[model samples]
Target: MLRIGRTPRQKPGGLKARTGIFGRLKKDRSGATALEFAILAMPFFVILFASVETFVAFTGEQVINAATDNIARQIRTGQITFNQGKSTDKTRTEFRAAVCQEIAVMISCSASEAETPSKLFIDVRTVSSYDNLPPTLPRTGGAGSDINTAGFDFAPGGPGTINMIRIYYRWTVITDLVRPYVTNLRPAGSSMPNDYLMVATSTFQTENY
Candidate 1:
């Protein structure tokens, strides 16, 4: 009779205690959505930036193609007429500058801007033959190479002739976050590895002019 009121029997496995703890956690869903949003934000931004970079790269390629085609037409239609009286070297230099300027405008590049000129590599070649042709590579001259000699042949006429005008442009994403995502964004077989190059080659017959 003097025994204290018998303590309530303890739950056999503490299931009630565990259930209470878990039930409280389940009820507190206030921060769950916030945690999920934080987890997803990074990848979403990455994907968005990647998409923008990809679009810029494609737009650049199309612009280069258009400029190349225009220049090639000029070369093929004899608009860039070869004159025996004028120095071919001088004429070719002017032609390259003109074409490069055209491409600059197409891709929103500034020809006068020293910081990004090298970013737009414009190589125009007038190859006499494509046989046993070495891969087109960037020249390392102090003044840089001419557009007409940058790539393969864009000859007016010759045996097994292929008149080609190649335009190579490099675009560097100001943002490094998206650079790795783009494909073949740089020049073909280019040694400069960090930048994306866009190349456009237009080949036609001189006879067609």
Candidate 2:
């Protein structure tokens, strides 16, 4: 018995099985692409939405500024030809209508509901004289960037007066998901975290009518 050679060894099946398992793992590509996509999906969508939001914001900005400039033209041309104070009430109503009328249709500038006044916060006032005009238009403060609708003064001035029209808008993000990538200009305690401020100003002297 002792003279028998080394015991017959079992076939290396276990080793071969491990090698096959590792081989299959390397060749299996089903989940590889999915795994990569899962890792990059968040950033990809964030960029996509952010880019779209930027374009929309720029468009809205142009709308507000252009609308204010256009409205200013009316006052400058004497279309708003009215005396101050006594005629202020009527002028305000008409001017407000005009602002909404020429508002950017794409933006939600109208708020018939009491809860939302108008998305457009406006102030039209005339300084005592052109010499008194400040380098920057006067504005009341609120939650930092927010303009309280109550503080809006609608005084388009009388003919031959210097008047300024100021507009403010709180453009909100369609989704909060992309907010981190964009700057949040709204002050602290803002009603919405996704809100950004937009302001436009137009100043011109009302011509003698």
Candidate 3:
């Protein structure tokens, strides 16, 4: 007796053969849901993080404004007096202390608080008259100052001298989306690195005391 070998033939649509119309219909559709979620999740997170960043920056600016306005009254009413001579270490410390009192409580006001004092820059100037007052916003001069240009003297002039206080906080943007949109004043090679700038200013004449 002669035995013949024969191969097993697959039917037109086998259970494992995913090639025909029936196979295509039976294919898994669960992955479609995951793909849809992945497509939408990215934009959702971007928008969410961007909004959080905006809120943080805006609130910080408002805090700085409030703190500056609150401190200006002290200078306006002559509570904080200026020495007739140059700006001494004691005067600088006292001014910083006053600023820190209101600002440090809310956010890191001084670089000293965070190991970098330039992070918060204060400029205070008292001139004999408003005619001597420099442009308020978009200051062309350098960072934190509490003095006048005349020999770089502390011009918190006594009795009825016009005074101006300017505060700047280099606020870093949280999200990358905001960094480009927000203001970035610091140059690329600067010691102090920041993305956005928060500025607060107040001007008043000192009371005769």
Candidate 4:
């Protein structure tokens, strides 16, 4: 009798072993790549934005400080008028111009260089003698209405005295990205309307005999 050819029997475990290897490979694939990217990107973006804002705020402060210091020096040296005869408005305009120029140089920002003329406000107060005792007195009032109402008096035969010069500037950020965060870094609105106030005071004793 011719016997039927018998096929070799396959091992039952072989198929299961192949399936297990493929399953593990699929599971090990780098998971949630998109989620990983999103998580990593947020902090970088926040840091970058914060750095930009901080730099802008710092630069603005430096520019304002330098401008105010220069104006104070001019007043102290008598280059700018503080007496009653000269037009206060005219002196104010000139002081503003000088400050703007100085700030432009300091910051090198086009916005700073081309600031709106209306944004600059200056007040000069002169007191020849405080309480009629000395030739001059220390100038005060950087944050109140007292400076606006007070007047400096010249001693008879005493030198001219300029009690104070206050410079106020309303600087608007050209880069709006960081404006809100830094707006409060400036002086309070009580001293300035739209922005911060930089007050530089210089007391001068008249050299005129």
Name the best candidate (by TM-score): 2
Each prediction's TM-score against the native? 0.65, 0.78, 0.69, 0.52
| Alpha carbon lDDT at 107, candidate 3 | 81
Q: Local error of candidate 4 at 33, Å?
A: 5.8
Q: Give the TM-score comparing model 1 with the true structure, all chains together.
A: 0.65
Ranked candidates (lDDT, high to low): 2, 3, 1, 4
Ordered from best to worst TM-score, the candidate numbers read 2, 3, 1, 4
Q: Across residues 1-209, which tens digit of lDDT does each residue of candidate 2 receive? A: 56967888876999989999999999999999899999999999888998998888888888888888888897788666455444333455566666777764766545552233456677777888767665653334543444556656677776778887788777877868866455445556534466666789887887876
Candidate 1, lDDT over the whole model? 0.60
Cα deviation of 127, candidate 2, in Å: 1.4
Cα lDDT tens digits for candidate 1, 1-209: 68878789888678988999999999999999999999999888888988888788788888788888887676665565454243332244466566666767556555553233455554344455666343654454322332333343223442234565556666676556666556443333444335566777676665443
Query: lDDT per prediction?
Result: 0.60, 0.71, 0.68, 0.51
CA error at residue 192 for candidate 4, angstroms? 18
- Give the poorly placed runs of model 1, Cα more than 4 Å off: 1-22, 84-90, 104-106, 113-117, 129-161, 183-193
Distance from true location, Cα of 68 in model 2, Å: 0.8
